[model samples]
Target: MSINLSSFTPYDLRAKLGEQLNEEVAQAIGYAYAKVTKAKSVCVGGDIRLSSESLKNALAIGLSQAGCRVIDLGLTGTEEMYFATVHYKLDGGIQVTASHNPKNYNGMKFVAKNATPIGRENGLEEIRVLAENILNNYQTSLTNQNLGPIEKHSCLEHYIKHLFTFIDLTKLRPMRLLMNAGNGAAGHVIDAIEQHFQNHDIPIDLIKINNHPDGNFPKGVPNPLLHDCREETSHAVIDHQCDLGIAWDGDFDRCFFFDSKGLFIEGYFIVGLLAEAFLSHDPKQTILHDPRLTWNTIDLVKEAGGKAFPSKTGHAFIKNDMRQRDAVYGGEMSAHHYFRDFFYCDSGMVPWLLVIELLSTKQQNLHNLLKGRIALFPNPGEINFIIEEKEKAIAEVENFFRDQDEKAINIEYFDGLNVEFKNWRFNLRCSNTEALVRLNIETRADPQLLEDKLTLLKCLLNKWIKK
Candidate 1:
């Protein structure tokens, strides 16, 4: 009985589930249950998508079929799922979310016991293979199992309280702040935090934009990385004369920051700030950073008496590296901040909290505190080039630059082609899941030179593409 793989597309399954059976979700759950054979119980959670409930129901059925008990924490973020894995002493956990993907898109994220991320190199590939096999088989013994007892545990309150423990509110000064949830799961989290502030008699003015959790997303996708999406958040801060602005992606797993002047602070600087913050308390601590942005981070971490290790850019990689290195903190230039205390997973909440604390303690403006580092690492942000020949284009650039005085710098091919000079460095790497190459370049304290080098790189890349 060969099952047609083409017939089991995620979209088709989504539609079929909407009509009659949730076979895709059942496969996911069955796969999870089979993976965690030793687990007596598993914690389950999901994002704010409408289909999450149906998918979760199917998943719960699969878990029960495998003789594993299930605990449901409905409408929670990915971080909360990680927290539940440890909080309830569950053997494993799954978060049904597409994260920052569009409203129509949905997927599942999984973790082993102790909140260990299961990515491609880890166990995600195995899970995917098993799930696909289960979906294709469809002839498994169907036991008329009774619905497992579901106990509702509201971890939101405890999650919020845990966030506050990482920062000192008493030292936070009264200031105007702008927050944008971008119509994602962050609305509930932000509202909960605000309620806590009010309850504690903290006098802070909050200006909010798109704080409501509307899945329709009248603005667009909740990704603040796009310039168009960030405009509203930037405007809110400037218009309200707010001291700072913060925006979260769809699931609120990553957050972006804006200073008092409505300047979009690069995630690199935020990483530096977080590294310094963590190092202040735990000197000589190991810090994990993505390979994309290295110079500034390495310098900052070293100056703060911390060892900086570069990991491949992604949540799973950072989480794995953090666990291996026992790093106190990890950060990516895309604004995902990971904390060892927070299950070694990225959190949108911690970065802003630490930034607020830094401002309050230093009594300095955000821009001023980061001015020197910003000058040192004048980045052109990240530019994506869609090409038919990604590898060829990368090689062309490497060859063109390889012969330009080797004695002045070093070239490393860890993740991609990284060319490091005395005062400048750049990395050009193809995206893992997209048909494009991403370019990130930085120089030592000269904006003009940075722009010039970026312009040259783009022209050079264009020439390679044409060839």
Candidate 2:
């Protein structure tokens, strides 16, 4: 009945369903979350994963046992939980979703009041301790907890309306776009948006594929960031003559974009594009970005009369940093974009709506909007290596660069080892959830330097991964 507490990573709880995650574990986590946060009102939801409903029901039972009024959101994406928590002014919310993980895996993402994350750094550890105690020894500090009522409510209409607020609907252009849901939780959202566009007389055409919620993941996990997973979206863009292409993962918290030419635009460049879009609308404000790839974002943010700050790379760090700096926007190269107005939470639906509005206002395609920025700041894309001693490998590479480059201008240690020179720079960091070291190299208008630096890093990290 007790599950492995090791499943609680620094960010969220995720692992193989049965061995590391189960109904008992979910209930304990829910009970512990209610106790630790003292959240009297909470919302619970889950994705289309086969196990998610059961896990969510157990979790809600625990919350109800703790006397917390539970709003059950049935089947929804991760962002819906976030929005529900903030929109309804609940004390906490939990979503049973594994995001882009394989079908065999499932997990939970938590948010407190205002949609702030609950993680190891904050209250996840306490939750883990309490949950483990309750699950294994049947112990509790407080006795005779009051049971509260559980209500089934759907916040879909309100959530869909909230998404349109990010862009002006009147300015939306008449263009064809491809939407690939990969048979995840995103299909219903796309369908709803399309129906809204039709009713409102918005002239955009929507082409949908894999637009059904299926636990089977017939198309394989819905992660368009992978090279092979992108084929369907890209080919569909051309086949449908779409002006742009869009795709989402299992939970649809993050979205990927493809240009009209069926070329996959790097999330790095898209970050810059989104920053530009926000600053253009607001004139001036702070923007947060990850150090994995920075030059383009910095250039665009500065040019758009905004200050760009680098934050530690994960969602927890980015959200905290965005609040600290009061940033209007924050983006990571991994396709996560957080908004200031949206309770500082990331949404897959928001970024695309803004982009389409941008295209309509600017009277250009996605490629034209990106080509110049892409050329100005060229990167070979992120290269990842599976290394055993990743920390040691990072230290060695950092020392090598420190010793070699006497003129390294801006060496940042916020999230990773980023050494910046005048023309070229690179960031090498260990992934928190994997045995991999991610390397990112970017050059300022120098393709040759980018290639050379990439080759050098590939050769250097080659030995570390070989073992």
Candidate 3:
């Protein structure tokens, strides 16, 4: 009997361990990626999951069976595969990771040349169909000649060097930093970066918490967005008196930060901070931001003499938009920071480095630097609710506010439903990765108005969810 992979999405194939995802399914997906991308040489990597290695092995075997040379970057994060693909000039790449999902779940992230993402509108659907076709038509027609060779390579040094390019080592302040790896794939990379800094006498003291690469995830999955997941990092920053705190998700693709006072800064504000940082160095640079939270980023960019463009959410959309606009920087409130210098792909490591440089050059504490901005743009961050009828919920929210006693309210559907009033606005959209409907709201220095609207929206969201 042929295997079925119903868990495959446009961006990746994810499933619980030994369930929908197994050796056969992973192999088939690899074969599909090789066939669809016409990749002769490919790079494969995986996180510190127990089942990840087996999946990686299956993927390598499938690539080999398709007569393609596979470069194995053992126990690597998602971005490493991206870096390997473009740096080695390979045809494509795959990284095995569920990315902050439960421990038993594992998945794969795919990309074409130059680390370009293969999403739904791009090549992911094609890859999914081909993978399913291969699975449903499975047979024992395999032979030795069909299998190629799997070579092992390490690009850690190159990746570390690339990260160094984002900041001036000499200008980097000798400050203690609290780093929480969440026992995912970020520890090794963090170690590498720290080593280089130490060797160069950079005097950047890195206080790492949960730094070991443990698939067991004793401290729970490494999603810093979760209020609970950030405690350790935040406490460490406070106890150690660190200048800054950094945390990453399971695959280290998304990075989150806490100020010197151990206050977790929302990623929404980081987008504006980064925009200002880049614009400070070179004015009038184009910055691409997601439409979810626009006013702060737009205002910051414009004030710095930079152009701000809003793109739909998601890495593929952001990267494509960045390329089209030749944007120097792109950021999502979800902690995904993309750089034009880094092949327009998001990087968790780069964001922190850039932020450090901003602090050092400006001679301001992390908290002080962002204090005014946070006060100016108070956001409650993203609130997600599980609603089966996502479309209806969105429409109801839109209709409820559309008839309000207000004029000049703007509405945009760049990614989802964004209803804008002059003093406050909210964006309601179904999550691409989950069944939840996410709502992000911001106000023009009006805390009470923001809270009032948020409470009103929550009530509406609960009403719709119950229905």
Give the Cα lDDT of each candidate.
Answer: 0.78, 0.90, 0.88
lDDT of 1 by residue, 250-274 (tens): 7788999998888899898899899
Q: Please give the range of 10 consecutive residues that has the lowest summed lDDT in model 1.
A: 7-16
For lDDT, the strongest prediction is: 2
| Model 2: residues with Cα > 4 Å off, grouped in runs | 1-3, 141-145
lDDT of 2 by residue, 212-328 (tens): 899988889889889989998999999999999999989999999999999999899889888999898776799999988898898888888899998988888899989999999
Give candidate 2's error at residue 115 in angstroms: 1.1
Query: Which pairs of residues collide in model 3?
Result: none
Off by over 4 Å in 3: 1-4, 138-144
RMSD to truth, every model: 3.4, 1.6, 1.6
Q: Return the lDDT, model 1, position 354.
A: 82
- Which of candidates 1 and 2 is the stronger one according to TM-score? 2
TM-score of 3: 0.97
Candidates by TM-score, descending order = 2, 3, 1
